[model samples]
Target chain A: MSTNREIHLASRPQGWPTAENFRLVETEVPTPGAGQIVVRNRFMSVDPYMRGRMNDVKSYVPPFALDAPLDGGAIGEVVASEAEGFKPGDTVLHGLGWREYALLDARAARAVDPSLAPVSAYLSVLGMTGLTAYAGLLDVAEMKPGETVFVSGAAGAVGSMVGQIAKLRGAARVVGSAGSAAKVERLKALGFDAAFDYHDGPVYEQLKAAAPDGVDVYFDNVGSDHLEAAIGAMNLHGRAAICGMIAQYNSTEPPAAPRNLALVIGKRLTLRGFLVGDHGHLREQFVQEMAGWLRDDKISYDETVVEGIENAPQAFLGVLRGENLGKMLVRV
Target chain B: MSTNREIHLASRPQGWPTAENFRLVETEVPTPGAGQIVVRNRFMSVDPYMRGRMNDVKSYVPPFALDAPLDGGAIGEVVASEAEGFKPGDTVLHGLGWREYALLDARAARAVDPSLAPVSAYLSVLGMTGLTAYAGLLDVAEMKPGETVFVSGAAGAVGSMVGQIAKLRGAARVVGSAGSAAKVERLKALGFDAAFDYHDGPVYEQLKAAAPDGVDVYFDNVGSDHLEAAIGAMNLHGRAAICGMIAQYNSTEPPAAPRNLALVIGKRLTLRGFLVGDHGHLREQFVQEMAGWLRDDKISYDETVVEGIENAPQAFLGVLRGENLGKMLVRV
Candidate 1:
């Protein structure tokens, strides 16, 4: 195809983003230059972190430029290559998404085997989200065997993986909180010892009831009350890996919960925030162990895919609204 | 001298403790039992943490029992001893403060030398406060040479030592915040690169102006606005040692600052809370280092002394009110 369609940041949102914040544009696909590869994208990720980039604020990653195509994790087939070690017809992963075509320096893309798993898997369980859960649970929070683990947003991509990893790694009990009853059920199905719908009651009371023995490690996805609940139920010297705060991403006002932060002093707790980009050293070990878990049917994952690049904005909004389960993605 | 005047917890306060919450009691001095010693207390300590113990809440240490004498760091002369290696006239430090006389197991007391330093020094610079500053800065916060350090309550016992230690140990710059201009001046005299009176302006603005680059280590003695300010000024991977929350101790309302805690995720920061009791392993090294600093005139300390056992409760109230320049002590 000589034509390409991509989504751009039309405007910065004040709070919750809408379709008006994004613009879809059509342009001619350009030829690859020296040492560059052009890929026909298949599946692209719509992650919660993209919400932060939509705002005109500095963060770990730069804000998405206005009137420019937003980019993220994408898997596609290389249609042309001017670089060694990459060729046409090879499936590869790169950081140029929300588009039908991606042209980048060959070094930016990594070739993956289609026989090992579906290329869509590269956007979820076997990719950044999976590695995030791995490093955050084991390395960041340092979850030990026989310790109880509590996870917020337990049905979301990273949160689901964290709960399962805790159970698989010999956590005595795993408790999880989710927005809906359906998501809570999904957590239990994923082998969580206990799961609760945060909407049903106060998070502190629910978390207390769910993890009666107190949480030893907390994998935080949704902050605010979930964080306060974790702190209230955390055992002495318990730790928390602050991976994401999806609950507060669109908030124009400061979060009022986690008000019990003073408990950290008396309990001697540690709360550490981390980004997946910083944990690249664990990639090889993570992939090997994750692949083995998948091959042996020791773990499972779900995907909520929105067909067509035109719906990518909706997919991302769905993630923010908790409308999608597991990994939210857009099918190019 | 035959009778001992001790301070007892009269009642628990809902928000802030008052003189009414404490009662002075006079009782006969008891004979020492086997393995025990009776000491006539000279100097006693009144600290921020004691305020927490006044409440009937389960914390790291048990709450003070009603109508029972409060116990803490005290130095005295042994008037009677029944244990081996103990004798009359020997100076000892023990945990039986807020009283004129103390009777305790010999193991609970550590013999100290009066020639080394004033006995009251054991309650401030050469004791728990000193070790707290050492461990919280060097160990808990993992502060390294050439890093920028910011400390709240920077004129208090722990905060003053934290600033001096950071300066002596090669900190690139040290910024601190205090309640008054005098305390701010004291911090500057202690070799802080910059100091601010938190009462002058918003803590965030003052901290931003003081440490223009950013803060790498935050020794948090006062929470609320100070914690919020430090988080705002912290660089990537910055750490905070949460030692105390003197600002929030008496507040009935939840803290409204530190609302930007979500920044921890993007900034990849660590906020760790710790107690001095857990850092006993570092006491030997801390004492040696602190004693050397004192001897070489590398460090200095101040104590706000409130005379008489009858005024011990008022002294503790003064500490909570930030009336102390360094350590607040009760002289018996």
Candidate 2:
């Protein structure tokens, strides 16, 4: 047996979570039980949605228990196995994260080919993040061939993939809004027809300038002012896919509602919210299509990786502050 | 030729409109030209959507032209005809209101049989209002059987139809929010399983009590606090058909947005705005179903009729103030 280092939720956060809210703990790396396998985690994900799980409220996913090791999407190699069709040195994806090693049922881990793409991609563009973008744009927003699409948080994991998917699907115009000038430039480099820094001016004005004709689909990730801006810039019969609302996740006070929602009536708009977990049935179709796009060099992805499981909390905080350019992950 | 009395948009109102904004004028009732018909108006409809047309801003429907006769749903007897498929004394429905006479293209009028139902019924239960409820609930909201439905503006034209239709379609519970205690009782009399007077308590609390298990569908008409309350009480995968936002139509300032919109994400909710004009394709099906429902004694309707063409503006104001029991109409 060997000792493993893992991060635990030491306390509930009041506002913005800090390192003090997390604690690095040591535990014995357990042997695989019947029908179980042991995985040595290579990369663990720290997403914006995790912020919602930290709060003590009923949501789509349950809240993280106090003093328990946090769990999420992770990519790792099989160190040991006791089930059929399992072997050592196999790269796999599982839902046990923030720890160096995990003991999980063999059925819970999915095998991934390391030669096809880097192991980190399974925690990002080829994994949950990629599927979120795919299902949200194609199914939730119902993107058509000639329509224009606008995405908020355009440089982040899901947002970046959304813009690319929309463009590849024959969008007439693809626009994006990011927090910084560099991220805006990065979005343009990623094939977005127009990109704007929301801080440059009011979001609605910047969006109007970027999408002069009006947007047919809006991929909303930031919520609040971004959502309001999207509502204003959307054309008649426009659709919005509400993926996340990271802006108000940590606020102690209730966020002010978008003031222009009434425009929805005259514009005949549709806004729908979604969770990636509810769409697991799309995995096979998503993998087949996304893998082909990657091989064809039609899509690109980025990652901001932090070293060591001890730094996982900081990586999470960085994501909340919009410091990461793409997928934020922790290398254990 | 005879002198005809017609109402003109005298001036635009800044806040709530008054009788002074409308001017009754006298003009010669012109004879029908080629492919046209001259109709002596009987009953004209006054509705909430007309308030949006009073504004100069662009919307689904064009704003009423300044100092012109306002157009709306009206039923009249054809006094003269110069086109095929029509004759004198034919009762027809046309887009001409706040007037004692109308000269319009023959194609714009549809003949109705008074032997089937009253002329006013063609403007209310069997007209646009009925289709609005039918399509908004079945098509836009995608309501399912065994679901709970909550409708705002329960005593108004479209909302009353929504409640009755949901009940007849096998809704587990039909809840409604109205302005007066009498209106609440009337909603129950109309087959609403639960009804409350929003003026007696906070809308959210009242909705919580009315639907303790949460609502599956919300048909929004009154759009301020009632919309907010619906969002608060919606269950997972809930749907909202936003037909109108009468509460904010006359406000000088923008109404506050629904505060709990973030719940949409975790709940996987869908909110869609629709106009009855875009849904004219459903008219044939809706008329077939609603006519049968009415004839079979499965549905009932009410009309708050004000006398004369001069009282049209007051009746419209009364609708805005929730003074009508169901459909508000002008007997010209």
Candidate 3:
């Protein structure tokens, strides 16, 4: 008999979640039955949205079940397979729990090649996160060539991809906003024509400094204040794709948006809220395009890796606070 | 030579425009040229949108020429025609200014069937304003049958049509918000299941009281506070079609949205801003459908006419303040 280690939801958080909300426990490792495969975790994602899943409420996706393993994006190797699609020694990615090993359906497991890209990339640039940036930027934002594109949370996983993708799509200018000076510089190095440290002052000053002509399209990852700033900077007939609101997610007090909703009319702009799953049909197309870009060295990625599964709760908390530069991952 | 009594833009206003901003001037009536017709004004429209025209900066349409005839939607009688299609005493509709007489291109005039619909009705119900309400509600909002629709400025011209159209399309429940108790009652009489006066404390409170289960779609005419209220009351996957922002037009101070924009992601709503001319391709389709609805009594319309061309500015100010119920017009 082998031991299966898992992290379960110890409690629901009110504001910012504490480590006390998560519990690590050991269980008996059962054999995989028909149509099931066993995966030994290698890498796991600690994303901003994971904080939302821990709450017991309605959202785009269902909340994490109480007294159960908290599932998230994980890359692993098929240790055993009793299903047609997967075999032992094959590398895979799936929505698996915070555990050392997991029993999953063959359909849930996608066998990925290690030759084309690094294996951990499945948790980021080549995975669900990348697909989100692609669909929201291209399909939703309707980003046209030569238009200026601005992104919030510029140094984070999704925002980093959003800026780079906008540049690759031939945007005349690409601007990004991040929390730290280091992250801002990092974003500029990743092809963002201009990047601002939002913490230093009001976003209006930073944005004006970066994009004087105003932005034609804005991909918002950090909501609240960022949305207000984007509105001030959108040009006539501009488009804003609402992606995430990490800044306001932890606020128990009602959110505050400084007046600028009227900008929608003065500018004749279109503000659209979107979900990544709504664009799942674009996944194959995204993979093809992203693969070509990666092969040509036209795209690059960064990851902030935590060493162990036991530190996942802390890693997730850090992601929400902008503590990681790039995709936050845990090496299990 | 006959005198052409005209209303001209005398000055730009700071807030809540007054008579000082408009001037009625008298000039010689021009004789028609080879392809032109002399149009005698019969009916003119005074809409809330004209407020935007009063500003100095450019918008969807250029600002009204200062100290010149402020021309817009009007129905007139062709007193003289040197063109093939038009005849003497031909009842036509054109952008003939707020004047007793004027010369215009015959091609710019469209013959009006006053026998089918009243001449003033053509200026409101079958005019640009009607088409705007219809297109925004049906096309941009993409309103589905049996969905709940909430309209702001429900007793106003476009709002009235929006509610009726949603009802005609089999809406589940239609709620509205007006500025007065009389207007609230008028909305109920016009088939709105529920309505409240916006002056009754916070709009969010009144909105929630009216739509307890939450709103599926919102037709926004008055932006800022009303918009934030609607955003707070929307259900999951809701849609908001922004037709106008009458509330913010005359404000001397910049209005800030106190409502948090993050609610957009929480509810996954879509808010789109549109102009009627942008959807010009639907003109023929609109005429056929709106005409049929009128003949079958499937729809009804209302109007508030302020006599004399000089009072156009007053009527426009009244329309913006929600003092006029239904479509505001100036009969010259």
Candidate 4:
């Protein structure tokens, strides 16, 4: 039997995670039982939301058990299958724990068509991140043609998709905020009408100067300051879709919203916090549309990939710090 | 020509407005020319939104001109008319300035039918306050039958209407939060399934304990802390209609929000801010429905009438401070 490397929690971080918080262990690979297949992980994702899981707080998803193997979105190759609809040497994506080799139930894995897109692409562009952007912007934000759209963290995996999708849906202007100059440039090349480097100044001023007419739809990836800024810059009857708050993720203290919330009354703004998982009906439609965009080169994606399972915790910490560009990934 | 007594803005306030900010001015009442009419004022209104207009800031409506008479909702009798549709002695409601007498263009005012509801009801239940409650709850909150609803400031004019209307629509249960014990008692009598004083304890704990199944809809008349508490107590796929943020109206400093915004991602919550002016499409339908409710005694309204125009500033400041139990009005 082959030995596989696994990454387990060393200890939970108080705020930002560190490499020391993860412990690498080696375990013997067991034979696949009935209706099970062995998956050899190729690439894993490290997202900003993983920071919340490091704490023992009650949330939508349950907290990760202490000293247990960490799991996230992963793409792998099936070396062995003990059930139908699977065979030896097939690539798949599943919610298996972070390990070089994993024995997963055959029913839990779906065959990945390599000819359709890159295996790593599934972890970013054609995966949960893409679906989140589409559902939150279209279904929750209720974006209409000819309206101005603003996105926070515009260079991230989800923001990039949101800007492009807005353009495809005929948005009059698409503005986005990024942490670095390079990301802002990338946002422009990806069809954003305007992009601002948030580090240049208080995001409120930069956002106001960028969209003078006021934003019609605000896709919030960073909350608190961003939300307050959007409230100030929104036109009458604006809609705000709150998807993430990466800005407040590492704060031990409570977040403070600006007093401008009073604008909510006069402007008739709609601020909705939504999750993509809530809209199950849109899955097939999203997959079809996103696949077409990928095939036709209408959509482009960026990734900051790190190699080896030992680096997952550090990469996660980096994501929480906004150090990585686009979607943070680990190539095992 | 007849003389009219008008209340003009003398200065703006720092925190709570005082009587010194307003000055009663004497002016000649002009005769009706073309479509104009002279209205003998009966009941005048002072609302929290006027606080925003007092500041020389850009908003939905332009700031009140410095050293000029303040205009707001008013009910009066048309003592003279020069327009088609309006006749002498016809009672009307319009955006008339705070004064003993108002000279207005006839088309700017609407005739009030006291046979359907009382003339004061035009400034309260059949006016903007009632429309605000209707549009916020039905159009913005999107209430479902048998769903639980939670409303803040339930004894206030807007909140009172919201709770009663939700009950009329077959709400499973409606819980309300008010500032005083008397207001809480009034809310329970106003058809609230449960009522609590916010001064009792932490609203988060109170709301969570009272709404174990979680509130499906929240009609937010008070913002800041109340919003944070509601966020914690919301059920999966909840909707919040942000009508007004009375809690933060007088705070010089911004208030802090709980670090629970990320809960929106898990629960698929939608928090939308709105103003009644944008929902003019529902005006006639709301008037018809609310008038019927009032006639059948299915609806009840309360008013705190401050006697005379000289007390308008004090009355407005009182409304902002939540000192008025229901719709605060001035008898001219």
Q: List fnat, each candidate.
A: 0.84, 0.83, 0.54, 0.81
lDDT of 1 by residue, A84-163 (tens): 99999999999999899999999999999999998899889999999999999999999999999999989998889999
The digit string of per-residue lDDT tens for model 1 on B172-258 reads: 999999989899888888898999998899999999999999999999999998999899899999999999999988888988878
lDDT of each: 0.93, 0.93, 0.86, 0.86
DockQ of each: 0.87, 0.76, 0.48, 0.69
Clashing pairs in 1: none
Q: Residue by residue across B155-191, what tens digits does model 4's lDDT show?
A: 8889999999999988898999999999998988888
Instruction: Please give, for residues A40-84, the per-residue lDDT of candidate 4 as tens digits.
Output: 899988888777888898888888878888888898888888878
- List runs of model 4 lying over 4 Å from the truth: none
Quality of candidate 4 docking, DockQ = 0.69
Better DockQ candidate (2, 4): 2
Clashing pairs in 4: A271-B271
Worst 10 residues of 4 chain A by lDDT: A253-262
Ranked by lDDT from best down, the candidates are 1, 2, 3, 4
**Best DockQ goes to which candidate?**
1
Per-residue lDDT of A196 in model 3: 90
- Give per-residue lDDT, candidate 2, residue B134: 95
Question: Chain B TM-score for each model?
Answer: 0.98, 0.98, 0.96, 0.95
